[model samples]
Target: MIVHFQDKTVDEQSRTSDLPIHIRSIKDFRKQKDYESSLSDRKKSKLDINKKKLKNNSSAKINKKIHKVQVYNKASDANFLFAVLETIDFNSHRPSNNYRYPQCVFRFATIIAIIAGRYAYEFLRMNLRFLLPTIQTIENNWSYQPYKEANFRFEETQTYLSSNNCQYVFVSEDCSAIIPRIEYDASLDIFNGFVTPVVEGLPTENAFRCTTIQQLKNLFETNAYANLVNIHVAQPIADSNNALVLPTTVLAAYGTDHKLTAIDILKRWLIIYKKFYSRGIRVLGFSTDGDPKFLRAMRLAANFFVRTQILNIYNNTLAFKVKIPSNWMSWFFLGSTQLFLFVQDGVHLCTKLRNRMLSKSAELTMGSYEISMEHLHDLIRSTNKLDHNLSISDLNVKDKQNFASCQKISDDKVLNLLLLNDKYRGTYNYLLILNLLITAYTEKAIALSDRIYCASIVLFYVRLWRIWLHIERSPRKNTLSEKSKNKKKDQSPHFITSNALLCIELNAHYLIYVYLLIEQNVLPQSIAESTYLFSSQPCENIFRNARALSGVYSTRINFTIMQFLKRLNKLNALTELKHFEETNTEQKIVFPVHHKIKRFMDKKQSNNNNTKLTSFNTHDLEKIILHAYEIAQNMANFVDLSNSLIKNNMFNIEQSSKIAKQLLHLNCLTESEIVDVDGSTDDEESSDDEDLDTYNKELADIMCDGDFSEDELNTSNSFENLQGTTYSGVSE
Candidate 1:
């Protein structure tokens, strides 16, 4: 105990200092030094080491306290600092740059970050803690890829199409106005913005080829965004439950100032058609907004209905075919082909109808029939235009695509009010045409018989309507309403806006198409197969999305074509990623759009239990057509050529009666002489191709509408089934 005498003063001073809990035993050991000597020789040695080895020495232990802390990387840690700073798992040090995220994870992160912007992307990245790729990484991955116009992405496109075995497709084209600006595409090495000449459906790459500055200057001076005529592919899938279809943009070419002619359109269509045909995909139809040129093209192609072959008997059976029945069935196919139907956009039809309804110059009056805007004005004044959707703002002439306005005016509620007095039977007949047609196209494709019940009357009603509104009519001055602001320009019906001709053409061609399809056995006559599903809706959605991605203000809608192209890849990337992430069984679309207005509805197979299903009468479609016209004529006997609004009736009522029997229009059976109608020039129907998602809701609904159980189909044995009335030309 006296061994520390020499250093006693120093030890005493050092003892006052605080020591770690682990070394506290040493403090007691200093004070009780004699206790170590009292222990055995072995115990004394053990005490100096792990004191537990010494007997009765449990107190001489080291209490090492272990602290628990949570650690998080920098990126994720920053985001939570605002609200959860105390609880967040923040990393004390920066993470290693060597970590590589999985391909899918980074791609998802990149899409989210990019949409928000570079600044937002960085901010997100800090919160994601290196889970997202850097902004530079995404930029590098998306480095300049030129969109080859008319250069179909055969390899890339066939990816989903082949998977779903999609066979039928429609080629839809519409022009969206673009910002007229000249820009050099480095890849194509040509000035873009001038209308590119389309040769065989392919944009001529060298149209603006220039090495000199003067040529470039000239190109710019004449530059127009050239009306971005985007050509997209719409595949109307037969039946995949409630699967959706995404539009595939195959060609993006600008147009010349003048719209393409029927000949040009056909040539381009045939070229594009062949490309798909070679790929084992069959094109069923073409769709567009109501452009006169397109209407002309469709009429030219519809020549298929008139060109028929005589049925020859051989050995009490069908004879061997000689002429190309295939070409006759189609507008003009090089070989065997399907029917080439033309579908106008339904939304456009509604708009066109609205335009006519609000036309200031012309009044909807011919003979005893009348449906004028003045009538609407009377109704509006009565109701104060407050209790209904109709309003004065709906008549803005500049807004041609005003579907909302059209719907409001065409609303059943508004029409019921118009017919409140029951004095406007003819007016109601004319007003309901567009609605019936639209509901037929966009909803379920009811039986031809059912559709005809509503459509045929409307078809004949237009014949009378057109005869009265035609610009060539005599005594047009006094016939014009007294309220006309101008006599000539205002009273005279505008060619496109009149829609009297358009209505006739649509219903007539629809009859012809139904007749031809029923005869061909391609469509199930027992039920109406509304398989015509391709529309410019896909193209419109593309424009809508382009606007959204640009983050532009609502007012400034114009943008360069290149800017539009750049957004496509990014969109495609995000879409592809979304598809991979979600459980989607939809065909045609690699990626679906997230649109607000798109409604998802469950397709219910209509109950045939309540209604007796009638057998499709495939025998006499001409008879059916005549009946439709006859029915309309019977309903309204006001249409007499001699007593017409025009006073130049040279023929008697006898000739007019003969024309009515044939179910022909007034143009052919004119008073001077009966003119032969060119079957090719006949018209067809329209589609309200809204968003693809909106379309999906009704897809299976329409698909199964025509599809009935075996028992339902056998309910009635019609002449069409028993007599086998399928066209010999189409069958051959």
Candidate 2:
């Protein structure tokens, strides 16, 4: 058994006499003996062993904690804070001397941070703590300053990331304006002594508005800001002797003094133009009108900034020649082309106004300015090709003579001269003449003679005669055979014959003349009458020559006439002629057949009542009588047939007339009926009511002929056929 005690004694001498013994006083034990040394030596060894075990355990614990921390940090940490920090440095502050920033990577990171941090700021803020170590490390190693200014600088940096240099200066000025508001007294009275009794007085308020131009200049001079270019200062034209007359109220507000100041500013800025251009900067200046002073200022500025004799000369020349700048000229040219192609001139301005209202710069009305610019651009671009440079004074003696001689000339030279008149007055007049011709035709008011004359002239001009002559020549090659053999698959057949060309030309001439007549309201009423006189000739003669030439049938001619009639009827203009009075005052002309027929019918009736004559005379009379009877029978049969078809609604009036005429040509009607006065029937001699009814019944039977059964045939056809066949067919 082991025991631990403050001192070790030789009471164990009874068991081990030779063991070392140490004695000491309880209070001064270390001074008493070597026992203190032995105990100290043993305690030092045990302490060394415990110290070694503790060091190992602590190291293991620290390693485990570090590993857990690393896992947590890896899971939650974001690079967004570093991105923000880098963006601030890149945009707000210039880079340090030692640290070379990766520009593209910085730009990419800045964009991502701005976009991603939009709704994830809490996550970003939490992870920002992790970046503090990195920041501190950077500060220690590279002497970097992260938070030298207030956090607002970071905010400002973000705000100005995508903003222009001018926008940043404006933002600062806006901030300065708000700062004054915080110090202003809201309750201060405006009217100190008089206003309380008479009316309610408002508090005096002083609102601070920053002068941005001055503030921006101060910022640029004081701070290491990015280069600013194309700074525009619009000074109003004032009611002063030096001020140029401007077109707007805003321009009038800035005094002439301010305009002078602006000119000076422009001149100074121009001096830096070359410097700016070298560093990728562009500068521009614009004003409402082409002011001489402004142009002078631009010239001076260009000379100062560009720093070259050639550029100065170019600038001076451009300022003098082009009242507006080239950018505006290009804009005008392109815009005008678009406008001309899509919009008619008169309506274009109104369309532009509507479009301008919806644009971002709605307050500005620059449409007319744009149009002028476009015109200038067009003039500039076309000057070389079209020789638009030729002025009125440039006309030679021959040109003047040609122009003067156009009045009496009808040659191609005159036509070309008129077309090149530049004023377009002659073209307008010629178009008007064409319009008059068109108006006259459609109104159908020109005389047929006049129409024919105009048509002949039109055909000559349109080359219809030449086209006809060409058509008279036959094809040189067999196109059909070649096509069938498939020698050339891409080859098309030539189908445009000379006749077809002539017809087309004729049709065009007719259309043009018609257009002129209608458009000019020049149609004369006598035109229709003349046309009718020419057209009313017997169809046989009128179409005979045409049909023989064209190999067209009479039926086609009739069809064409019918179509023309239909078209005329549908035209309301021709309907007015339906009520036209026809007056024929000439004496009635009689035909020789009329007198013979009248005498024969009268003599025959008289002879029927006389006594029987000699055999030879009786035979002759019988023969004539039989011939007359045969003719009467044939006429009756024709009339019966016509009446039959008409009664059954199978024939119209025109058809019946045609049938009656055919019968007459066959010598079907007897002299008595044929000689009936002025084609009138005798009241008593004509078929009586009973006879007419009998005739109609027989006619109906004949009309039905083979189609009707025995029961279907009426008395008209049966009786007529029975009576006519015996007299006409048998006797003849």
Candidate 3:
């Protein structure tokens, strides 16, 4: 609306001759100028801001967009490239004519970067102290402390023993078979105290000192008893490089010596007893095997220690004072003092019994009647040699033949055969009856019921044997001359004849003593109680252990003792841990396989056979008897030939008249050969020869004509029980 015009065209025409000038609105023109000015100012401000930003970051390198890129490679390849490039660069910088420029510099740069990184790591490690300790520092700083020595001196050991309430100490001496030559030989005298609490199953825990003669003397002289009041005497002896290993301490070993004497051994025993007695330990007994020297020593020692005293009589009807019976009055034990019993070892006694049974020279009423043991010995030897364990039925015909041919069998096997064979039925019954009594006395104290049963069996067998012997002999007396018959009719002949019979009779007396003792409700006062300790087996066990540890040819006893103690200590520790673990967890029961069973399994596997044999629980005696009975029953037809021998005052009769007919073989006896009840069989009635021949033929057929199976021929299970009887119940 507000417009203005300028006269530019007329002035331009006059001054410039034909220049055309156009007129414009002033508002529109002003707007156009302002817009242009505003645009120019904006451009200038943007340039100023970008310049300021560039100036602040002037130290940073330019970020150029690189299109040309170097090829990447492995370190090994890069190293090879760097070596090649450096060689080229070196040649290029050299003054020689053959110098050349490198085509690529990337590998050289990479090698430089690697060197820079290694240098950086080295610098960091050398400057840092709180990073890690050196190996030397660690090794020197941490280590186990040095072990200190044990505080168990001689005095401490003595004090420990004296303070404990030790009672019932037994002394045992045995020569260990370690390096058994003169100077290298060694003996040990172990002092073991009875276990506390006196439980039946608990083993002896009071392991005391094992001392030599000289050490024992030292202990006695030094008042090792701690000045106690009780007085008893004991001395232990050792010679020929003997060493003593006690639980807490090792005594000075005895040096090499010659042979040891009984007197020296006795003296050592006295000293040991005195020391133990002073320490409040009642020295109850000394046990040893029937070694000749030991026996002599014991006799001499007993005589020396024997004392006599008069005991006041009690429970007698006489008033004031009753006279002591002469039988009751003895050289020892007439006063407060008691004499230690010197009884033969039970195992030794049993061995002697076996020897007596086998000896032809043994004095007996039967006139040197000996039981042969060749078959038993051969059977044992053969059985041992078999690769597989054989069951009773598993034994082949060859094995049976071998066993039957043996002539020197063991006593138990002989007894077992006697029991099974109908020919020796009388002897079998007698042995069984006596064996039960022996078992009751040897193993454990019998109950009242068992004692009554045992007594009944014994009495029954005795009465039966006596009556049989009397009736059998009575027939001969009826046929005797009238004058002789009249003289002997009232007198009963003593029929029990064998040495075994006498021994059994003596054992019966001991059994009766045991029964009376039980009835009186008294504890066993005898030296050989109804316990395994009746044998010197415990001492023997220690000797076996020592010998095994020392080896057969060891000479240094001290070294042996040290080695033995170290092993014992380790074993004890392991035992303790095992006991602890077992108590905490449930116990696992494991039944041991019997030897026969093992053999049976081996035979079955080796032969690759599934045939079942007649099995038995051999642990049970009843099963053993049944098994043996089966074999006997199978072959009993031939037993009738085992006719009983008759006596007609055989010692006084003529040699032809004294011909005794007994079972000498497995062949049957003929009816025609049977003797009359009277002595003169020629005048008596006789059986038909044809009938006797027929009977003999039948027996022969029964013996020879048989298709015997493996089970029928097998005697392994039948005789196995006998092998266990001799030593199984003796002692460990």
Of the pair 1 and 2, which is ahead by lDDT? 1
TM-score winner:
1
CA lDDT of every candidate: 0.47, 0.25, 0.30
TM-score for all models, in order of appearance: 0.63, 0.17, 0.32
- Report the error of model 1 at residue 672, Å: 27
TM-score winner between candidates 2 and 3: 3
Ten-residue segment with the worst summed lDDT in candidate 3? 705-714
lDDT of 3 by residue, 1-732 (tens): 123224565565466543334333454567899999998899989989988888755624332212111221222333434445345446546654443323122212212212222233235424532221222232232221111111112222233234322234345444333221111112223321111111121112222233477854554454221111111112122111111111111211121121445544454444444444433444444556556555545544333222211111221221111222233222111122123334334444344333433344432111112123333343444554242222332222233322211222222554565554344443343334435544433333333234334533443233233333433445654533332324333223333322223233323333333333333333222312222233344455433333333222334432222233232222222222222222222222122456864574465344334423222121332233234333322222122211222232222112211121110011111111111111111111235222110101111112210010110110110111121111100001
Each model's total of backbone clashes: 7, 30, 22
Q: lDDT per residue, candidate 1, 131-207, as tens digits?
A: 56676565544423345443444434444456445565556777777776666767677665667666543566557
Candidate 2: which stretches are off by over 4 Å? Answer: 1-45, 57-281, 284-732
Candidate RMSDs in Å, in order, are 15.9, 50.5, 31.6
lDDT of 2: 0.25
Of 2 and 3, the candidate ranking higher by lDDT: 3
Which ten contiguous residues of candidate 1 have the minimum total lDDT?
704-713
Tell me the spans in candidate 3 whose CA falls farther than 4 Å from its real position. 1-166, 180-258, 300-337, 355-369, 374-417, 420-530, 547-732
